[model samples]
Target chain A: MPQLDPTSFSPQLFWLAIAFILLYLLMSRLVLPRVGKVLGQREERIQGNLEKAVKLKAEAEEVLAAYQKSIADARAEAHSALNQAAAEIAAATAAREADFARKLAEQTAVAESRIKVSKTQALADIRTVAGDLAAAMTSKLTGVTVNGSDAGGAVEAVLKERA
Target chain B: MAAEHHSPLEQFRVEHIGGNLSLGGYDISFNNSALWMLIAVAAITVFMLVGIRKQAVVPGRWQALVEFLYDFVANMLKENVGNEGRKYFPWVFSIFMFVLFCNLFGLLPNSFTVTSHIIVTFALALMVFIIVTAIGFIRHGLHFLSFFVPKGAPAWLLPLMIPIEIISYFIRPMSLSVRLFANMVAGHVMLVVLGSFVLPLGLAGAYISGIVPVAAITAIIGLEFLIACLQAYVFTILTCIYLNDAVHMNH
Candidate 1:
């Protein structure tokens, strides 16, 4: 085989050396750097994206917390408002009931006073009538005129004894 | 016509271009091997230059291919040589690309396989051997001599084991170079031998008798392509391993 032949060895080695060194320089100085730079840039971009995602997630959580806080505040406000409304209604009902009771009591007192006045008037009429009757009867029996004032005094004394 | 040139070995002949040129005693004349080497270098240079010209953050197809090769070599170095191997990335990468391209280009019609030549492979292997040995001595100083001493060997076994270790250590270049050269030579020889049958059979004879060799040639070509890539990988990883031994000084 010509490959086994010794004559071709030196030229092949010389060219191999030159080409290899040149290729090494090209790759190390130029090609590899460019490729490495691009890869590094991609890695940096992905890392930055991940960091942004985390930051955005934190911001979303903060917003969600604020939203939850507002909901709770509104719920508390609604509860207090409901409680205040309930208390006002209760107070109004109590005040209305108290006014109603006061007015009813005043009417009862007026009615009782009217009944007392009527009762006293009725007793006085009865007393006058009895006194008149007694004077008439006494005058008729005795065939003489009886004094009204004396009859009234005798009726009053009899009524007081009966009581 | 085919019977006249039946030697498959003829394909490996390195004919000098433009007569022989010698500088002092050295035969520095440009030859077929040199020409192919230049072609391989130019091809790689162009491929790299065009692929990386854009340097896009989002890589185009060519740029992606270039990046893929770069990362492949980088990862190989990192895996075999560790982080300290980062400094040797360019050399390892160059060797891998050069061997790979040379092997592939040799597959073309009438092209020379530079790696098939023992001299070329030996040169590469020798360079790696020298670099690794220098690194070993530089890192470990006189302790580098201890590399030939097997750990856990009894004092009486020293005489037996020491020579074996030393010989094995010295044989690294020969093994590395021969492994690549032999694989290339064998594959190319098979291809040429099988291919030689095709022309001799003629068209009518090919229909009658050439089917087997043709099919074999096709299959062997595919296998050769695989071997080309694998051999390149093997050569590079072995270099990394040797470098690792140097750096770590592990027996």
Candidate 2:
């Protein structure tokens, strides 16, 4: 084959060295560095973005936790407020009921004392009338005079015997 | 037809560009092979330079292609040579891109295939071999010679195995060079031969018969393109494997 031709080998090698070395220099010095920089920049950017995303996510989670805690606190506060209001209302009602009961007892006691006084007066008036009536009847029936003190003494003895 | 008059090997003929230029008793004339190598280098330089001109974080199409190639070589080195390979990224990357571009460019009609020449491929292979061997020696000193001896073997078998090991180690450059050179030459020769058949077959019989060779040539051309890329990959990975062996010196 022409490739195996001995005379062609040197020239090929000579140019190969020249071309390849130049190419290598171009790559290592200029081309690769620029490409490498861009690639490295992209990777760094991606990594930075990912880290930022993670940080933001963590922050969001923290805020959510705080919000949840606040909600729980508010709920507890509302629950305590409701219980306190119920207790206060119950206490107020109990106090008003007790006051009303005390006032009712006082009014009942006054009414019972007034009824007792009126009954005693009514009994004394009845006793006086009966005594007078008894004296008059005695005088009319026997046609004899009866003394007031004697008639009172007779009514008193009859009342004592009946008691 | 003229197709039958032409030789398939004609394409590989190296013609001088001008008078020979020699230095130190050497003929270093610029030729077709040299011209293609320059073209390949120039093409790569332009491609990379233009690709990164914008340097946008969000890459355009060309930038994406450039980045893809960069990552491709980077990953290859990482996989083969580990972190230590980072230092050699430029060398490995240049080899891959140069070989790949040369192979692809050669597929163009009437273009020279630099890799098809034994001198070029052999030079690349020899450079790799020499460098790798030097690395082994430098890292391990004289202990690098122990690489040929099997770790666990019968004492009697050392007589038989050591030579085989040594021969295989020495055969690396030859194998690497021949594999790439043979593949390129075979593919191109097949394309030419198949293409040459179209005209002669047409003149011999029905014009419709020309379609057969034409279709075959088309198919082979596609296959050649795939092979070109594949050979470049094969060459690079093999270089990596050899480098790995030298760097790590595993049995």
* Fnat: each model in turn: 0.84, 0.74
Error of 1 at A48 (Å): 3.7
**CA-lDDT, candidates in order:** 0.89, 0.91
Best candidate according to DockQ:
2
Which residue pairs in candidate 1 have backbone atoms (N, alpha carbon, C) closer than 3 angstroms, thus clashing? none
lDDT string for model 2 (B1-251, tens) is 57444777777877789998998998888899999999999999999999999999999999999999999988998999899888888888889998999999999988999999999999999988998899889888999999999989899999999999999999999999999999999999999889889988998888888899999988889999999999999999988888888888886
Q: Lowest lDDT 10-mer window, candidate 2 chain B?
A: B1-10
| Count of residue pairs whose backbone atoms collide, per candidate | 0, 0
Best by lDDT: 2
CA-RMSD of model 1 = 3.9
- Give the TM-score comparing model 2 with the true structure, all chains together: 0.90
lDDT by residue for model 2 (A1-163), tens: 7787877888889988888899999999999999999988989999999999999999999999999999999999999999999999999999999999999999999989998898898887767777778889999999778877777778878999999
TM-score (0 to 1) for chain B of model 1: 0.94
Q: After superposing candidate 1, which stretches have Cα over 4 Å from the reference?
A: A109-163, B1-4, B148-164, B200-208
